[model samples]
Structure formats: C-alpha cells, structure tokens
Target: MERGEKIVKRIDTAKEAKQNPSYFEALVELLFQLADDDFIISFRGSEWLGLAPHIEEDVALSSITQNTMGHASLYYHLLEDLDIGNADKLAHERQAVERRNASYFERKNGEGSYLQEPYYDWALTVVRQFLFETMKKVKLETIINSSYQPLADIANKVLMEQPYHLAHWRMWLKQLLGSTEEAQNKVQFQLEAAWPACADIIGLGPKAFELEKHHLIAGEDYLRKQWLKELEQSLSLPSSLFVDNHPARGRYGEHTADLDQALSTLSEVYNSDQKAVW
Candidate 1:
C-alpha cells in the first residue's frame, strides 16, 4: 500500500472498549504508550518553535507539533474516562519520575537553548521526527483494528489527520537527502544517532502478550514487523540497510534522566494550577 493511502484507509472505527478485564488492561497500556510517545515528542517539537532554519519551515513544523499535541490530548481524554485525572493535569502536572514516556523523545533539541545560544540541528530534528512518526503511523494502523472499541475508534480518527504529518516529514527527508553533500551527510549523522534506541519506540512494554491475548491490539512482534515493512515502503527514497537496536527498554517504564527533565518542564503549568480551571 502507498504510504499516504495506508493512512487514509485507517479512519473508520468504534470509540468504545470491550467489557473484558484483560481487554481493559490492554487498552490502558495501549493508551499509555500512545499518550507517552506523542506527549514527549511533542514537547521536544515545541522546543523547536521559532528555531527552525527557515520561516516557512517554522510554520510547517508547528503543524506537526499541533498534531502530536492533539494526539496526546486524545489519550488524556481516554484516561479521564478511566477516572485517572483531568487531561491537562495528567499532561502537565506529573513528575518526571512518574512519566511513562520513552527516553529518546525527551532528549534536548540539538544543543543550547531555543531562546539563546540556539544551536539547533535541522537534520536531527527532521530525521528523528520522520522516523518516529513513521513508526507511529504503523502502530496506529494496527490499533484501528483492535478489539477494544474505544482505542480502535480513536485510532481511526487519528489516522485521518496523520497524512500531512507523514508527508511533511517525508518531504524533508527527501530534500535533505537529495540536497548538497553537507546536508546529506548531516542527515546521515542524525539517522545514525536515532538508530540505537529506535526500537524502544515500538516496544509494547511489560504487558505485550497480555495486551494481544486480550485483543486490545495486535501483538508486539507483529506490529514491529508491520512497522518495518511500512518504513521500507514509506518513500521511494533511500535503500541502504540500517541497523536498529535498543540498549534500554522504555516499554516496561524503564527510562532515562531525559524523561525526568521533560516531565518536569511539561508539568510546570499544570502543577501550579491543579486547582484552577485552566
């Protein structure tokens, strides 16, 4: 299936979970994975605001941030249904240690501050987001077929808005890879940086089998295979064999200081106004 077309066909689903206990647990884990991935990455993306290489690129990238933020919000709302907490509080008030996001998403955007000493790397940003979103699209595609109705339903809705995100990143990848020698080299460097922990993003955590057995979603191994296949066919671009490995697993809640730092930043506002409407 074509990359864009794959996303388009993933838009029909029911928004309710199956009334089985195992299924509910699987649904919860799936939601956490989805929420954490987007929440952490979107935070990183937000840090890039006004720091992109070009003005047009800034506007273009912001759309992705908004989309990821929207995805996070959707998961937060689902958590609310389980009486977890208000969506904003869940997003903004949690401590770093309590966060369930992967470490990679929480990494700093290149180096220096976005406001001053801004030494951002466009290659890293583009490659990381592109690769991450590509895997995310794969996972969401499987979720649309989940037995848990609510998850499948939300997945369907999310799939509708994912094409632009995929297209935007694909364009960046193509242009940079096809650009000047320096640009191609930089992209290659970023891809290498992203390769090691890329597997963490696809992890199904501690409850992988249970989640699958309950029909909450597809199995981890299956999803991983699908993700790789999708990546292979994502764009008619490069064809070099890439190495993928995971030194630290994020699925079981194993994380790094990066996530700790990110949770603190994201929760600052919500933590302060936990009692307020905003």
Candidate 2:
C-alpha cells in the first residue's frame, strides 16, 4: 500500500472516530496554529544550533528549540487522531499557504544564510523570542481555563512545561538589554526592527473572530493589552516606546519574503516523497 494510504487507514482508527466532533474541530484548528508556528520557528532555531556566539549558550538554547519542536509533535499527534494527516507529513510537507502559522515565527534569523556568513543577530532572536513567549504564556494561561475540555487539558500540560522556555528567553532578553554598550545597542536595534512585525504574531489571523467567539481562545486586543501590561511591568521600559499599529497581520495569512524562503527550506525534505511511508 502507498504511504499516504497507510496513514489514512491509521488515522481512521477508533481513537480518531471517538472524539466529541464539535470540540474536535475547534481544538484541531487551535492545535494546528500552535503546532505549525512552533514547528517552523524551532526549525529556524535549529539552523542556529552550532552557530550561536557562545558554546555554553548554544547548548542551553538548543534545549528550548528541542522543547518547542517536541510540543509541536504533541499537537501534530493530536491532529493525527482527528484525521488531519500523518504527524510527519503535516509538519514536513505542507506548503506555506497550507500552513496556519504566523509570519513572525517564519522570519529569518538574520541577514545571512545559516550555512554561510551566518552573521546572525543574537539580540534580535532574544528580543523576538522573549516577546513572543510572553504572549504565548499569557494566552496559554487563558487556554487552561477554556470551556473545551481537551484544549484545557492540553494547555495545562503545555503550561507545566512552559516556564523553562519563558525563563530562558527572558534571561537572554534581560541580560542583553541590560548589558554593555555593544550588547544594548544590538538588542535595541533588533527590538526596533522587530517592532513592526511583532503585531502579526499576536493577531490570530482570519480565524481570530471564530476562535474567540467559540471560546477556543481569547480575543486579540485583550491578549495584546495584557501582554503589553506584563511587559511594561517586567521590563520597566517606557510605555511610550511601543507602537500601536502592526502594519501586517500574519493572522490574515499575510507574509513576507522571509516566510517564503523559510517554507521552501523546511518543506524540502517532506515534499520530496510525500507519498512514501518514511
């Protein structure tokens, strides 16, 4: 039998059929968004695996990358039970248009390719991840109280393991932002560059209305407002520094060239033999 056929047969099993259907749809969409975002970004993170500026920091950072990928796998497996697709195929083979992830997560690490002249901006990475994880933590907190039992259960599980991701990024952000002239300059530079795209990650895209209305997740404004509050309090930065308008919303499927490049790189292996079992 063809690999796709085998995957289909496996997905058609009892566990797939046993879910509460209504909750299943909502939960699946949430899972896809969560999983795809983490998967793509973590892949980007892995590209920096050996290229990090410091060896000790490299080891510590890889742990977060692996954890995020692991979380993505959990969501993908959950999706498999819902008959979406095989976990590996969904993660590795999908086109950018088919991917439900945010553009922020898909953006490049820096100016050069990971394989060459990897002048990666560690400060940008630190700032973007710290900001992103802060929002994710806030949202996950709310998700833990969701009306959908499955989501709430998963959210609880994710939260249990999330502090490490948060702490790691937060430490990087604080240290860089609070450090010497060069470090602070680099961090500030990246933070400003990231300011415009930061909104896209939190927008929740086309399904925002439905997700919130159905209680699958919280509203954008609420999450944004709360996230800003927490960030301001934590960083003690001037509140006036943040910009209100995020020009492009990734939640709406709007993306940049970086996303396209990233999609091509990540999907290259899976798309090669989508029909094969391996």
- Candidate 1, superposed: residue stretches over 4 Å from native: 1-19, 234-245, 276-278
Residue-level lDDT of model 2, residues 175-229, one tens digit each, is 8777899998888777776666656666666666666765767888888888887
Count of backbone collisions in candidate 2: 1
Q: What tens-digit string does per-residue lDDT give for candidate 1 at 153-193?
A: 88899999887898888888889888999999998887766
The number of the candidate with the highest lDDT is 1
Candidate 1 backbone overlaps, count:
4
Top candidate on TM-score is 1
